[model samples]
Target chain A: DQQVKQNSPSLSVQEGRISILNCDYTNSMFDYFLWYKKYPAEGPTFLISISSIKDKNEDGRFTVFLNKSAKHLSLHIVPSQPGDSAVYFCAASAQGTGNQFYFGTGTSLTVIP
Target chain B: EPEVTQTPSHQVTQMGQEVILRCVPISNHLYFYWYRQILGQKVEFLVSFYNNEISEKSEIFDDQFSVERPDGSNFTLKIRSTKLEDSAMYFCASSEKGGRYEKLFFGSGTQLSVL
Candidate 1:
C-alpha cells in the first residue's frame, strides 16, 4: 500500500546546513505524524512528532512541519552534523486505527564534513 | 535508559518450518507491537498486543502468524509455517500507552531468513 511515500531516496548536505526531508500521505484519516532515524543495523529511533491540531512541532534542532491541506509533512534539521547521517522514515496513524502506523520507504541522509 | 531487547539477532530456517521470535519490551510499557520489513521494503505492521490480548492486526498478519505474552514481560511472535517471503527484519516495539499520539520504542530487530 502506498499510503505514505518518501519520494527522495537519498539526500546529501554539508555540515552546518539545513536538511529537509519530505513525506506525502494519501490517507487523510491520519491525525498523528512521526519521524524516525535509523542506523544501518539498528531499529528506528523516535525523533519528533506532530499532531493534526498543530502545523509545526520543534525539538532542539529538529522541527516537523505539517500541511494538512496538501497532505504533506516535512522534517527540518538545522546545523546538520555528521552524526546525523542516517536513514529517516516518516510514519502516520489514525485515531481509531488502533495506533497502527504506516511507514514510508525511508530516505538516506548523508552529511558531509 | 531502558530499551527493548530481542533475541536471536539472526535466524535461518527452512520453508514450512516453524519459527518463534522473542522480545522483552521496556519495563512499565503497556503496549506491544510487531513490525516486519523485507529487504529494500518499508516496515509493515503485523500486530499490536495489550493486556495479554491482541488489540489490532494488519492484513499481512495472517493465520500463519500469532503473538502471545506467555509471561508478564516477554512477548513472542510465532510463524507456524514459514515462507520465503517471511524473510525480513522483525522489530518488537513498545509504547507507554496505545494511544495514537504515543511514540514507540523499538528493538534492534531479529532478522529471520526463510530458505
Candidate 2:
C-alpha cells in the first residue's frame, strides 16, 4: 500500500523559476514530514523537514509546507537552479513510530537553463 | 560533514544465497536504519536499529532478514535465502537521535542483483 503518494511523476521548470512538488499522505498519524533530493547514481540527501506543529519550515531556497488537515505537503524551491534538477522524494513518520519513515514515489524535477 | 558509507557498491548473488549488506554510520550517530527500493518503486523501510536492537520493522522485513551492529561502527543487514524479488537498491541511514524532527543521512546505496 502506498501510504504516501506523489501524483506527479515528473516536473519541469526554467532556471530561476519556482518549482513546486506536491505530496499527499493517507495516514493522519504522520506527524513529521521531510523532502529529500537524489542525484543519479547517488543516495538521497536531506533537503528540508517540518514538524506537525509547524505549518512551514524553510532552509535557504528550500521550503516545506505542511497542511495537517488536508494531509498534504509541498516542497517549494525558489529560484530553482539547474543543480536542483533531480529526483525528489517526500517522506513521513509519526511521532512515536520509532523513526520508520514512509516514502512516496519520487518526482523527477528538471530545471532547464 | 560526516556521512554514512556502504561497502560493495554492487553485489550479484544467486537465489537462495545469503548476502550481507554492510554500512558504517557516522561515529557520533546513535540511530541506524535500512531502506530498500525496487526498480521504479518508492523507498521502503526495512528496519530501524537503536541501542543495538530493532526498534521497528515493516512487513517487508520478514524472517529471512536480520540486522546487527557487530561492532561499534558497523551495522549490517543480512538476507538469508534471498529470492529474485530481493533485487533492489538498499540504502543505509543514520541520525544523531530518533527524534521526529531529526533528518537522516543516507549512504550511497548498494545495488543487489539476485540471479
Candidate 3:
C-alpha cells in the first residue's frame, strides 16, 4: 500500500504559466509535507515544505498548499521557467518521528518555451 | 552550503559477494538515512539512523542488509550477499535533527549492480 501517492506521471506547461501538481496520501498521521525536484543523474534538491500547522507556505515563485482535511497537498510554480523542468516528488512523514520521508513516484514536468 | 556525498558513483559486484556503499553526510547533521529506487519504481526507504543506531527500517530491509555509522562522519550500508534484484540507485540523506518535518539533503546516489 502506497501511503503517499502521485497519480500523475507527467505534466506539461507553457513558459510563464502557472503549473500545478497534486499529491494525495492515505495516512492522516502525516503532519508535514515536502516537495523535491530532481534532474537526470543528480540527487533530489529540496524545493519547499509546509507544516500542517499552516495550510500554505511560499518561497519566491514556489508555493506549497496543504489540506489536511482532504489528506492532499499541491505545489504551484508561477511563471514556470525552463529550468524548473524536472521530476518533482511529493513526500510526507508521520508527525514527531525521525526524519523518515516517504516519497511519491515522481511527476515529470516539461516546460515549453 | 553543506551537501551529502557518496563514493564510487557506480559499483558492480558478483552474486553472493558482500558490497558496502559508503556516504559522507552533511558535516554537522545528526540523522542519516538510506533509500533506493529501482528503475521506474518509487524511492523506498531502507533504513534511518541516529546516534549511531538505527531508528527505523522498512520490511524491504532484510537480514541481508545492515547500516553502520563507523565514524563521526561516515555512514555505510552493507549487503551481506548480493543478488541481481539489488541493482538500483542507492541514495544517502541527512538532516539536522530527527524531527519528522526536517528537510533532508541527499547525495547524487551510487548506482549498484549485482551480477
Candidate 4:
C-alpha cells in the first residue's frame, strides 16, 4: 500500500536553474511531511520538512511547499548545483501513528554542470 | 553532529540462514526504526521501537522477523530464515522524540545478500 507517491521517476535541470519535484499522499491523516536527499551509496539525509499547519518551509537552497487541500507537496531547489544531484524522497507520517513513516518511491534529480 | 550507525556494511549468507543487523542510534534519541529498500523499490518500513518495545510494525514484518534492544546502546533486527527476496539495503533510523512531527536520522545501511 503506497500511501505516498512520487509520480516522476527522474528529473533533470541545468545548473543555476530551478528544479521542482512533486509528491502526493492519499492519506489525509498525514500531518507531517519531510524530504530526504540520498546519494548513490549513502543513506538519505534529511533536507527539509513542513508541518500540516504550514504551507511552506525553506532551508538554505531547498524549499518545501505543502498543499493540504490537494494532498500534495513539492520541493524546489533554487539555483541547482551539481552537488544537488541525488535521489529525493518524500516521506509522511500521520499524527498518533507512532513513529512509522511512509516514503515515496523517490525521484532522481540530476543537475547538469 | 551525531548519526545512526549500522554495522557490517555488507553481509552475504546462504538462504534460510539467520542474520542479525546491528545499529546504534544517537544516545539521546527515544525512537528507533528499521527500514529496507530493495533495488529499484521504495524504502519500506519494517518496525519501530520505543520504550524498549515495539510500538508499530508493517505487514512486511512477518514471523521470521524480530527486533531487539538487548543492551543500553544497541538496537538489532534479526531474520530467522532469510530468502532471496530478503536481499536489500537495511537502514536503521532514530528520532529524538516519538511522534509524526520529528524527523529521523538514517544510517548508511547494511546491504544483505541472501544467496
Number of the top candidate by DockQ? 1
Off by over 4 Å in 4: none
Residues B1-115 of candidate 1: C-alpha lDDT, one tens digit per residue: 9999999899999999999999999999999999999987888999999998899999999999999998989999999999999999999999999787788999999999999
Model 2 chain B is weakest, by summed lDDT over 10 consecutive residues, at B96-105
Reference-based lDDT, residue B106, model 1? 95
Interface RMSD of each: 0.8, 0.9, 1.1, 1.0
lDDT, residue A104, candidate 4: 95
- The digit string of per-residue lDDT tens for model 2 on B1-115 reads 7889998799999999999999999999999999999999999999998998899999999999999999899999999999999999999999999876778999999999999
- Whole-model Cα lDDT of every candidate shown, in order: 0.95, 0.94, 0.92, 0.94
Residue B21 lDDT in candidate 3: 97
CAPRI quality level assigned to candidate 4 from its DockQ score: high
Clashes of each: 0, 0, 0, 0
Shift in Å, residue B71, candidate 1: 1.5
Return whichever of 1 and 2 wins on DockQ: 1
Candidate 2 regions exceeding 4 Å error are: none
Pairs in steric clash, model 1: none
True contacts kept of 2: 0.84
List ranges where model 1 is wrong by over 4 Å: none
Q: What is the lDDT of residue B9 in candidate 4?
A: 95
Candidate 2 structure lDDT: 0.94
lDDT of 3 by residue, A1-113 (tens): 78999999999999999999999999999888899999988899899999889999999999999999999999999989999999999999886556668889999999999
Worst 10-residue lDDT window, candidate 4 chain A: A93-102
Indicate the TM-score of model 4.
0.95
TM-score for each predicted model, relative to the true structure: 0.98, 0.96, 0.94, 0.95
